[model samples]
Target: MGQFIQKTSFSEKDFLAFQDKLHQCLEALELVLERPGFGLGEPSIGAELELYLLDGEGRPVLENQAVQDTYDDPTLTLELNRYNLELNFTPLPGTGAPFTALQQQILDNLAGLNQKMDPWQGQVLPIGILPTLQERDFGPQVMTDLPRYRVLAEAVQQRRQSTGIRIEGQDSMNLVHDDVTLEGACTSFQIHYRPRGQDMVNLWNATQLVTPLMVGVSANSPLLLGHRLWHETRVPLFCQSIDGLNSQSEHPVPPPRVSFGQGWLRHSLIELFRETVQLYPPLIPILSDEDPLAVVAQGGVPKLEELRLHDGTIWSWNRPIYDPCNDPHLRIEMRVLPAGPSAADMAANAALFIGLAQGLSEDVEPLLSALPFSYARTNFYRAAQHGMGASIYWPNAHQNSLEERSLAAVLEQLLPVAEKGLIQVGVNKEEAQTWLSLISDRLQSGQTGASWQLQQYNRLVGNGHGNHEACLQLLKAYCHHSNANVPVAQWPDL
Candidate 1:
């Protein structure tokens, strides 16, 4: 979804042509994977940080274009909503304190945005979802003025046959809408891990198995549209926004665009690609002119644009990425992390995830094998609802019982595995301690961002403050602590 297209609406002929090119691209990918040393070499780390643009009063600001133009930086770009922006990072090798380096870049970019927003009274906030958001804010008029976004909204709406998108968490958020613009309400800090000389299928499956555990510790979004919902309401909000038909209909129901996955990868990435092509219909079918097979036949890398574009449409929590261009490596995109509380907090979350992935991948038995995929899937949603308070089932190292344990207890045991994993992946012991220790303290303190926000919000509401007014006050306090560069666990309650 990060990529762009020349047009929005597609004709039948255009779709057919695009499908043909997509098949050719898949064939090229297969041929490329067959070569020895394919996607080999050093691992790299990268990320995409999505942000919200807020006004002086802590409300969403629809001035992204002006802010983007004034701050003319290549790393910054527009998101699905006009009030949203994204910051991208150049891939760096997974050695040293890459998380620190990434954090520094984010701070610098954030400072630049702050400076540019000063004149317009627009401020940049790193958050999962703006607390001040209202249903009225999601009208089609507020969407980014991009044809591709419009086409997506129309397509999702068409597939639903005008049925409203509905999600029920702690508070039910239902929308009788005609488009998928509700997705724009969510923001995330997406971390990318490029593995080198490793079995990507196993790494991906392992990541999926542990994603619920990660979400449990990193939950940050506790409020949406003044409603107290899940720790990360973005999960259900995003899934329901683009949801389509079910099996009860005339046609078989394909998985939701935003999904955990159908099942673990059986053969390799090829199975993923084949499933995508067969399940999802093309939305942006603007075909590329380059013949991928011809380029590969001449010992050259071909940009599998069709395959990538299609892959982007499937919003798997953990997605497989194929970079046949400049980087020329295969990477796993961890889409479970949310934005903000602080840069240090975000980096700690990243450290925990990458380290856990690396450490867990080293085990002789895959984590997925030990835990059922359905259990993993269930754990993800449960964690989303209950955050650290949730009791999640894990394959115990000592016993054969299928008993459930608190997320805190699970993290206590898993944190060491992540620390070892980071060290194993060339991260200095000091650097790993610097970041991973924050997560450890958070677990011990029982002060995840979500918990902090919910407690503060409840306190303010109890003090006779209206929901809207209290949210604004909370945002102001959040900004103060976030800019202080302290981990969220250290933040004071209202």
Candidate 2:
């Protein structure tokens, strides 16, 4: 709960005891749901933004981890690679247009972060993929000296089957090896929403249905290793980067740790993790001892260190998460979204999610029964696979290309339902529409960071320039836009 919390190591006894405590946590959650978790009835939303460090040329700027040490902000943390930094925002209490409030916090935090980094000529940037990222950036030496990241690197490398990369399109890149940390080139903007109650069915269905929508509007990872693959290259790159199976296990079957998702979630949050532990053995064990039961027995709060550590190991897009940080009031977080070129964009993405979750919560069983579970399960994959390029097949059952349909199309289509859903929960119409509009306008014009990056990269490559120049230009423009709090359109012609 405080800065630099102690990380617990894995033990079978701790694991089982943690599981028992986890069950206790969930039981407490159910009781609180009857009274509304945390006295803030229904889902309250939050977001996490990941960013890149760039230089004047728009290339990634390596930092002396000491760069952050100078800033003195606890929320500012190092990412796996030195070139990346993650800004963890305090949970945003949703007022419908979460972005309105969320973006202000991001702007204030980023400005503060930049002011701290300014002396080194380094600045923050949000791009699907760092335009200037190269193989040189991924060496083990470049990974931050943090114990957690170092441990994670070794765990992923040891457990991974192969470092399979196949990014082919305007630019082609295919690689297969035993290292996956290179996939760290991909940066994401993750957002979280409390689902009020264990509305698993709605959560699962909305998670699935919004796949195409999430993709259409927020596809920033269009290029990787200087190669273009799908509109959102992060889709393939991220998946293959950490794939943890041997060549013998390559043939398609449900993956053990790297989930393409088994099926729609219809059970408790614990069920999802239970299924995960059953399917994949622990990857990396850590050091820990704050027995959750010990805390419960003492009439004190438990950190659930063992369970939290295990939960940290499993990564799912629409992951079923328990918010033990706020005992008796935990929420699941959706981590599939890519970080953006703008804070407004990120907020819009959150609005659409919270709205859709509200819109679809009551319609789950009927919706799931009517729609294919496979579609819901695989929608996020498709979103990741072809961001803004794939078609979302809706329950009324119509498919539309992300590029062709535009964000407004999805917003117009889903907003009414979202509004109705939110209104049903007393979250007035004006609040819902404000945040949703950012998404609507952004999508209508095909102006996502991914789309903009693809356009600029293509323009550069089409004109016979190497990636070095292309990325440099893109990064420069992106930072300017981010600083101005302006959309990509107002960033002006390259």
Candidate 3:
């Protein structure tokens, strides 16, 4: 993880200047001929693990300072909120045994994190959505005193003019949270895979095709404002919660900055940066006169001012990423996954992603030719809204329920291809099986993170333990019960 700066006060003019600089950088691209990224034949691999720092009762814990005190490792760094922490898995250059190594390192880190939290009545839960997360948990006092986060809150609120939440299910909710901390209810398992320069276009398309399936498999955060609207309500909440456009915005409005893009990767990665720079204004600004190209000439890596700044502002689901890399010097960050029940489960999830991304690039173009994109895209929102229970609007004029084109249905068709791709990249059989099986079992049982959480929530509720506070307590208990087991069937139910 890179160092984060403390947010400083900025005038409106500062933001506008940053946007103007970004535009010039995008324009500068047109003057230079972009070349194919250089890389070895080995596949790209990366992972991001988000954890909820919790107390023994499963309530949000602020042991950030203690955790930081215990370790000097930058890889395990503080998140935007004090209750949140993130682990940036080291990049694996070649694929052989890489997943296994990542698993071991992550487990070791988790052990260390748990030990540190123990004395403080704190622990880190890997569940996709901590069932106990509630409004009380995200109040001002809990807000991490970080400049970046402050800037984000102020910037988004100023533009969106509202928190924009509306959940309707067993219960109904329509409230505005002036701040975006409500977005903090989400914690995810993020994965990154390196795509070949020659096939980047196809990989982007395949990722779009698989977005809904991905969300369905990892659905969590089903209950919001005490309602059961969707299995993975995080999707809509995140987009709508931070949307800048006011109600006056008309139809065919620009998509919220966050989205599973309808358009394909038409050109270079620079195109993504350019579109963002052109559409959304900058929210944070810390500018310098240091010429990035001059640094490149000095044999130093150029951080590409425009690209990095624009990257900070616009966050799409399947984000275009540029990171320090030995191969391709860039990788795609798949940001849609929810957190995990156990460390192994999270590792397994990451493995499944690595395999699927590699496999999809080689197989999807022809397979997707006949599939209507609108259904696939819409179904993702539906899954996020309703989780496993919603009826999916079928592709084409023909109607097909989500249960009909189930996540399991899609996985069965695609997992083997992903398996082949993972195997080709040198993952051991057990490594692949340990992770992939979780997905298989979850789909077979139709129990996503959100579903399991809701089930657990109801069990507590029937026991007269129902309330915002009870939900958090149950999350605390679930973490206590499920620690490192990957085989969900063997793991005792909550």
Candidate 4:
């Protein structure tokens, strides 16, 4: 969805010329919101990460096109599996030491993809779900040959008539596939956040009421194919892997193109790109010659590329982008963290989401009218199945209702409201207390990254080591404690 389409078989006249260039890119986003100095004047931050390409015994290594033809960099790319790979960094400016320059640009592009996967032994891991993944490693001949990922696995397996695709927590799956290439087994790190003028819908509803306290202290995937499911099995294996296409007769209950929405967005931000072009349908209608209303009637700034390829197939954990390059901002991606156990635990989960998105975008518009988008979508799947032992439901006040609490009493009342929203956005209160003290020492040592990968996979299966050699010795001690950048609460325990 990062633009690049010539063909993948779209035709109904290419979905009526991409719904007439997605209604002229929603009338050039209401003429760039009646132009009053568009975005990027200060708050800026970015990331993408998404790794996993292992081999030397820790499985899955599709050579990401020979490490993108031997890593010629331009922020690398390709992902939708071929053993995945995605980097994309540049944005930066949300105040000093920007997470130590995005953790030294992700350890200098993970040491240049570990020196080009060392003569093809191929390693580069950064995980979310790769505990030796398998189920015949997600079929469709290991996807990523790309024609827009085979027209998005043939439009989400032709809108689910292919059926079977189950997932339940503590180990349970179900199959039947033709191709949504099991959503390339899941991988994420995705942060973004631009937020300038009109504090972008109160920092997108304070990032949807703090995505379950940033997926409950950033739970990494707690093992999948080797069972031991959800601490964050990539959040219901990425919302039941590309589900959607079960029209089973009646209509109107729509909204599950992988979501935690259907409420709260009390108006403009073009009502989430007009409810994603009025509720999905064009999983890749390809055609985009870009005329976002003749480039905003020639004043310039268009690239809405069919409303950013139909809002990049809507897997919204907290999406709503719109980046027409050169100072044309409007961000808020934050797709519920989860990438690795390191780069300082993904820059302390991006400094607890840029200090709770600048301390709840300045008092989240009257605490979003006393919160209740169904308790922030049921506190995001109960913090993706109990990571930090879930219990959520916040917004207190002499208990007028929603109480529940405990992710250490909601990180002791939001880590001093994300360190006074990272020292009111210019950060540097000792670089926002060194990445919010690694989320307050991973919430005072509760140790998350899925509780240190379920306590080092049950202490390497209680010292005997079985389940695929204890998930390749917990992926070789989680790549030597994520290449020694450390942070999963000081690692060591296993």
Please report the candidate that would top lDDT against the real structure.
1
Cα lDDT tens digits for candidate 2, 203-250: 665665665577656777777766766666776666666763342243
lDDT-based ranking: 1, 4, 3, 2
- Pick the winner on lDDT between candidates 2 and 3: 3
Model 3 lDDT per residue over 37-116, tens place: 43325565778888888776667787676687786787886776778888888877535566667777678878888888
- Compared with the true structure, what per-residue lDDT tens digits does model 4 show for residues 281-373? 767876656667777888888877777877888788888887777778677888778788788779878888768867877677766666778
Per-residue lDDT value at 57 in model 2: 60
Q: lDDT, candidate 2, residue 231?
A: 68
Residue 468, candidate 4: Cα error in Å is: 4.2
Arrange candidates, best TM-score first: 1, 3, 2, 4
* Alpha-carbon runs more than 4 Å astray in model 2: 1-43, 198-200, 244-256, 293-301, 397-411, 422-428, 489-493
Model 3 spans with C-alpha error above 4 angstroms: 1-7, 27-33, 36-41, 244-254, 293-301, 324-328, 367-369, 389-404, 468-473
Worst lDDT run of 10 residues, candidate 1, spans 244-253
Please give the TM-score that candidate 3 achieves against the real structure.
Answer: 0.88
Ten residues in sequence with the least summed lDDT for candidate 4: 244-253
Give candidate 2's error at residue 129 in angstroms: 1.3
Model 4 lDDT at residue 372: 72
True-structure lDDT of candidate 4: 0.78
Q: Say what the RMSD of model 4 is.
A: 20.5
